[model samples]
Target: MTGLTDLFELHHDGALAENYPRLPGLLAELTAEELVRAGHLLSRVDADEVLAAQPDQRAVTTVITGPGTLDGLVAPMTAETARHGLLLRPVLAGFDSYVFVLSGDDPEIARHQPDLVLCVLDPSMITRELAVPWEAEDAERVLAEKLDLLEQLVAGFTARSDATLVLNTFPLPHELSAALVDRRSRARLSIAWHEAEVRLLRLAGEHPSVVVIDLDSLVAEGIPLTEPRMSVYAGAYLSEELLVRYAREAGHVARQITGLTKKCLVLDLDQTLWDGILAEDGPDGIAVGGGGRGDAFQAFQRVVKQIGSRGVLLAAVSKNEAEDVRAAFRAHPGMPLSEDDFVRITANWDPKHQNLTELAEALNIGVDSFVFADDSPYECGLVRRGLPGTAVVGLTEEPAWHPRDLLRDNWFTVTELTGEDRTRGVKYKQEVARKTFLSTFSSIEDYLRELDVTVHLGVATAAQAGRVAQMSLRTNQFNLTTHRLQHQDVTRLLADEDSIVFTIASRDRFGDNGIVGAVFYRRDGELAWIDNFLLSCRVFSRGIEQACLAAVLDHAFATGVHEMRAIYRPSLKNAVVREFYPRYGFTTHDHDDERTVFRHDLALPVEIPKHVRFTGEIERPVR
Candidate 1:
């Protein structure tokens, strides 16, 4: 196979610039061997052009590879990462590109402090005796040894480093044995190997820091597993095509880790939900869920259902009449999703973008948390242009590929599921009820009074840490400071003697809205500095923010804190709370480009809201 040396022989530095522009057309025509060679050469320009334009603004990610000739794999991974960086430039905020650090097998994982650690262990790395495994007795022994080694490595990495680990499960060889085994004789080696794979896949569930990428399934799904010479020269096992997809998936993991993941999927009806236009064909004429042409729609709906189970809120923003859409969902026999599944539904004939805006408002989530999917290019384009924050997915004409296309973007991936996730669908369903109840009240205070709301301001227990961390990541609009934290980080804050971490949960006549606020404060002598102050938008405009601040201040004062300091670092999405601290009686002492500092004298009495009843220690802020 043509190697990197061959690429060097084919093109000198002078030819690189000329060939770069024609790179796309050239890739399709290249053989597997030549593609590998091209990847090596592409590595030479590691953001050379991208960095020349953006300069010193790349998102830094470190890649710790497993045992093998993996050094050769670095260039291809970097090239793929650079391409994705360009695709995700808008999502990355200030970063225009990504620069990666490729470390050897098992360097000090904690010392590196990488944003992500890609665990690229191959089957050979686990057990070298696969080829020599015609012997029956060594099979279980081999599997056990491999499992122990794998678990030890993962456990150690997680214990030492907080970096999100993306572990690739060991893939069984396409042809596992020399011949088919007679199961009556002994345990089949193939069966043993398959069991080992299952055990490897289950590691993600046991650990909070791991996201196992199933390369085995990727290959089975027909991403061609070709490795010509790179495995020999560079320890790389995947083909160029497979490697490209792997890197894309890796980038998705990285995006989710950084809180860049979208929260909601706003879908369209008509051809999108069924085979025919609902308005033109009428409800009965439109094809859905009775096999034949509607099979594709059913398949797509099933995928949407699966995603919702994993905690992505589903909603419909269609142009059809509300009654027609309701009837269509009710009439379809095999419809995978019901109206109940959707957290919000805007079925009227208003502008799709306006419906999306209303959905965001009703859900109390930012517009950027949305992913709008529609079969029509016109409707998708409207939302994309009108609501710049929402992710607009372009659909192909073929309905069969719709679900696959949606999955390709990797909008929702989290390292761990929180308490909030398990009940997210229920909470969002309840939110619709809460939004309806809001319109009945004359004023915000009256609404709060009528709901019989109660606020608990106490140090969050270990069990509630995950939900607190989630609010820190998802609460952008009402967040005083946009500091993204994970559950482990919140745990660390709790252990610090000088830091106070508080959790807020509110329940009314509607339902138990799980822990929705997190505040982290650091004690400095007689002063308490607020590091993060956030409340879920679900409880917004209800004087809950006032109640929260008053609780925090009262606690500080009781602890002998002379003054309270807070920093409000504004972001593009957090402008809604730009003046949040000032509204709650915090006096601005310093202002700068990065953050605005506010100070409150703890000696001064705080006013508690009349609506919310308190449940924990400390007096309700004095009126």
Candidate 2:
């Protein structure tokens, strides 16, 4: 009655479904027993009702299977999905049937065709059946067999389905070490166990569709690796606390795979970035990097820069004068970030929320893609209320812990990092220069001609699969069919003889935008149909889409294809491109409530944009 139950009682009609949104925030205040009780309470609520209450809900088909009783995880996992505005349509696998389910032995699970699959293995899976007095060689043999089974399962699942496979590195049980107490025996056992965990972590790197959760890291955070009593009686190897944390990590991966990841990190320049206020502490008086508390602020800045290097845009909103902030950056030698590191720096008297809106506009991204961090609670509250979609990180008074707090939710987690991600900040900085030059000319054509844009449009190489898959996921606005694909899927398409996977990249007088557009189509004798076509929103309104589509049509015609058909599936964000195909003389072939198909005859050639220049399929930077 003191924790979630009390909050439940306070709700109208004592309905726990109404409290679903607040459950994640109240987790820290709950005791272990209360957390278990809360999970049970959440499990009783109708999932359909909770999803109905959410304004923006994404339903992911999930399947949970392991070598033990995992029923308890389904509830906490459901609650975690609710926290992120996601609904889980889970297919329950048989208990202790990890191999059977993963090996394609279970027909229901195999046919379920889930979007996210969570498979957790515990130490007992290997230890319980180990031979007595097993030496290092014997341990290695068993580990090899288990690894083979896992690899086979992973390969089979990935080959058959596009769902992401989530695995975990299990902690070594104490029984293994206790049974082998001698120094030599203990050393061998420990080495073998460590090698096994390392091998498990390598699966994530080997398969683009696979993600591994490190249970050892969770245990390092003071959560007990396993509940002995539960393991002995209920066959639940993972403790409830560990399961809750594991569910959170799984939720992060789900968000990333579903294209709900944050794109930018907006910071406050006062006490949040530095140790003190610039107005009161003076330019040289502030603590930045000399020693003591200043080093903490410096460390925080270093972490922010590292994050920026990974393609997350950095921005700042400060109420101080613009010159004062600029002077502070110049005066501080220990500052890891310069004015150029940020895409936008707003230093004015406007409300922080208004500045954030303007920052999103300037960057050509949505407010929801931002993660705003401020040391002041008032400012955080204002942004939270003003833009409910933006993730707000309220930093405490301690600057040393700011980095940990900011990344607690893993807002920018990605499955794979590409060259474009590493250099995104620099490209945005170049965009600022492009905008400034655009204002100098009244005619758009003159501005484009002066900019000197060069585009690369051709069959995508195997090496460009990651960038194409990334574009498929993140390019929503200009996406023709809105198909979300993974790297493995793109790789598969690249190998098909009948399918054409092509990419488009643009570089102007400013900078290279990387692989900004892609098209997936299949050829059938003399006919072709587009599977999906998308262009990055950053290149919109620059005639890149027109140029790219023209090239695609011309290529199809030259290939002896008589007609090319394209589908336009309307999404909430892609209304701007609804009439895209029709502008190029494509006639409507079929129309429905959900989608429209347009067909183009290969009788005439499509004209490329005159202002833009086409280049060979090569990736090179002007700088």
The candidate maximizing TM-score is: 2
**Poorly placed runs, candidate 2 (over 4 Å):** 1-56, 131-138, 616-623
Under the 3 Å rule for N, CA and C atoms, how many clashes does model 1 have? 2
Local accuracy of candidate 2 as per-residue lDDT tens digits, 572-598: 678899999998888999999779999
lDDT of 1 at 612: 78
Question: How large is the C-alpha RMSD of every model relative to the true structure?
Answer: 7.2, 4.1
| Residue range 379-431, candidate 1, lDDT tens digits | 87677568765667777788888988788768886666777786787888788
lDDT of 1: 0.70
Q: What's model 2's lDDT at 64?
A: 92
Measured by TM-score, how close is model 1 to the native structure?
0.80
Candidates' C-alpha lDDT = 0.70, 0.82
Q: Any residue pairs clashing in model 2, and if so which?
A: none
Alpha-carbon shift of residue 116 in model 2 (angstroms): 1.2
Q: What's the lDDT for residue 239 in model 2? A: 89
